[model samples]
Target: MTARTDGGAAAEPSSGTGRSSSVRRTGRWQGVAAVALLAVAIGVLAKRPPLLLVGAVAGAYTAYPRLTATSDPDLSVRREIDPASPADGERVSVRTTITNEGDAPIADVRIVDGVPAMLSVSDGSPRCATSLLPGGEATISYELRARPGRHVFQPVTALCRDASGSVEVETSIAAASAFECEAAVPDVPLRAPSGHHPGPLVTDEGGEGLEFHSVEEYQRGDPASRIDWRRYARTGELTSMTFRTERLAEVVVCVDARPESYRAADATEPHAVALAADAAGRIGDALFDANHRVGLAGFGRRVCVLPTRGGRDHAGRFHRRLATDPAFGLNPPEPARAAEREGGGAPPRSVTGDGRNGDGADADGTVSIDAQLSRIRAEIGADTQVVLISPLCDDEASRIAQRFESGGTAVTVVSPDVTTAETAGGRLARLERSHRLSGLRNAGVPVVDWTPDQPLGAAMTAIGGRSR
Candidate 1:
């Protein structure tokens, strides 16, 4: 943001505080010198004592005029910034103005504008030093580097001091301005063929794709390349060939933001749950823009699902919700000792009601893990593609994925591996991690091992390749 000063000329001080202070100090010192000189003159000239006293008094009075010198200046400051939404690593210009608001003439004025922490000044400082009389103003300008996310403007500090620096007043003015630097996401073409699916579902509506659908009698609007020469030669009827519709796919991005997924392997912005949310947002946008139906779902203690929809509006809604979602680790299973490792054995038949195993059943004879998966599978249609986003640290998650895949659902695992040494230990821990991953992959589930250090688009590209 830039700064500037406005107005011109100095104004007289209504209050004499500045003049009074100067007079008081100068008069006292002059009075002392006069008394000493009067005594010396009386000694030197007993006959000229009257004349010496008059000279001493005259000298003291001369100091009074000097005390009357004072300057009362009125000063104000303003700042401005341009192109608030700058891309990361780009430069933005800042402008400022300083104005004389009071009657007194400010000998020296210094103004400083506060900059958000994310941005760094690239050229010149936000601070400006100058002199301004009442009604006089000055303008200052500079530049800064912008970073990603929202950045707020800080208050501007102004220091007004006299030429002698004996008297000074500090004032701060509020500036309600900010700049946003947004990061860029890679735009990859969506490959799904069904235009009905949410997102940028690519279609054969005059776009790139490979599929033949029908042929119609050629009209004036028909493209030359679409003219079916074989039909024209056989029956002497000109025809235009139409291709099959090829659009983006419908993708349901399910994020496990339950308290269980918040654990992180390292300190990073958007911990485990947040990372998953961000990745989901980026992938959802790409798919939606490619003309696919995209839906958002968050599962934890409670499940929040945004019905599948296609369009830019839906994409924005998903992002806003994800940004504000709660941040907490998933709840541990009740009766910690009863926590069953995923894929170790079938969960108790009572909890799941599948009659698969007896050991892991809950008190009510319910298979807790599989039951949840069953509900999820029921909610989504058999043909719909499900992308499960989570930091799969336990066996239940693996089992859930396995069940979904086994139930004829195409499952793509976006695993935000958040476990660190502090949570998992030794060879046993490593083996368990490997086992759970293997179980899902073996079930024909495409897995994306996403970490916090990499961009989420990278993971999606890898998954897209596998899907193709």
Candidate 2:
């Protein structure tokens, strides 16, 4: 059975087709009755038979709308997608065929296929308008470029109007449509220290690894491969080479879904919260591939925390939650606020014992960062590093990062560049964002300044070099 996704509960298919229909009055012919009355009055006052005929014609037109009967439009929608499992950044072509199953002819019909929000249309249109007779069909084709993550198509909307255009039957056609694309590991460098696990993170402690750390006098049972043969030959004594110890790390990929991070550089682009959520999924996948324990969290009006775990199953569940969970869904927490820095010139709030800044909330309903951080600390291990994805649009976001770092939690801030310079306010916000990032870096926190236009891997690589 085809699945329904209309921002509500799935509709059960009836008559072997998933369709739900509703009717509404368009009010297109409401003023025609008044015109007919006026014409009849003119004919009576002027005593002209021609005016009377005009009144009769107006009356007929007015009655035509009321006389026209439109049945519930029964539509069967079938969607065909080319290259069903598309690679990231691959263009996908979709064709939707809509068939009218009702006995009455639909004079005017409009159909709009559901397109996933994360996938942008690269070519063609998903909408079509035409007339459909009994058993007649219409088709619409569109192309969308795929991105990382699983995307589900919403239900198609079809509007059928009667011949008089006075009534409209709106139908939502459901079809099974969804695709999952795995994202490549970003290979983001971790400046934070690692947990005690054998993996790829290099540490100062000498152990098994390719990169040399130091050499010491050879001890009994030292691996022959690690023995410094040249040093032994020169000094007539044995020495052993010690390479940097590589251990895996437990990482929590946290996204800032607060209302302030919902800003987008332009209307066409996804908001910062959406971009951050996507980045968090990629980072979490990377850590998981390296056999490191990965946890997920979102800090905002509603905080969502998943405890640290390592495995393919955990990664799959983590990625799916990021895509479908209400806390991390594409929808913003609140209306997009102006991308201005936080108001009230005050030093960043320190981590208080009670996990509240003064009273835990402000008069404006803004929750204290300390409370949120406290929740995170309670769930994570002491060695767990936090990969914070935020827009850094407001000072409070920076404060959250700094607080996490100061509280002895390893924190890496990934700030997506969502500030545009199209207006004076945008320019000022961009300047302020720059200073905030710089301040975070100076405070000894590793910061990745990411622009949505650039590949995330490239940004991570750049920041990795800088941190090294």
Query: Which pairs, if any, clash in model 2?
Result: none
Q: Which candidate number maximizes TM-score? A: 2
Cα shift from native, residue 85, model 2 (Å): 3.7
- Cα lDDT tens digits for candidate 2, 1-468: 132222112222222235556687878787877888888898899888887888888889888987888877777776677767778788878777887777878899888776764556689977788999988989898888877776666567777788998898766666656766666568777864768888778777887987788998889998999999998789888989998888887888999987678887865456788789878878887788778889998877656789888899998889877875545645443233222214521111111111222343432565565676688889999888899999999999999999889888889999999999899999999999999999999999888998876678888998786322
Each prediction's Cα lDDT score? 0.57, 0.75
Please give the clash total of every predicted structure, in order. 63, 0
Task: Please list the residue runs of candidate 1 whose C-alpha ends up more than 4 Å from where it truly belongs after superposition.
Answer: 1-181, 186-208, 211-245, 267-270, 324-376, 421-431, 466-468
How many clashing residue pairs, candidate 1?
Answer: 63
Q: Residue 54 lDDT in model 2?
A: 82
Residue 356's lDDT within candidate 2 is 21
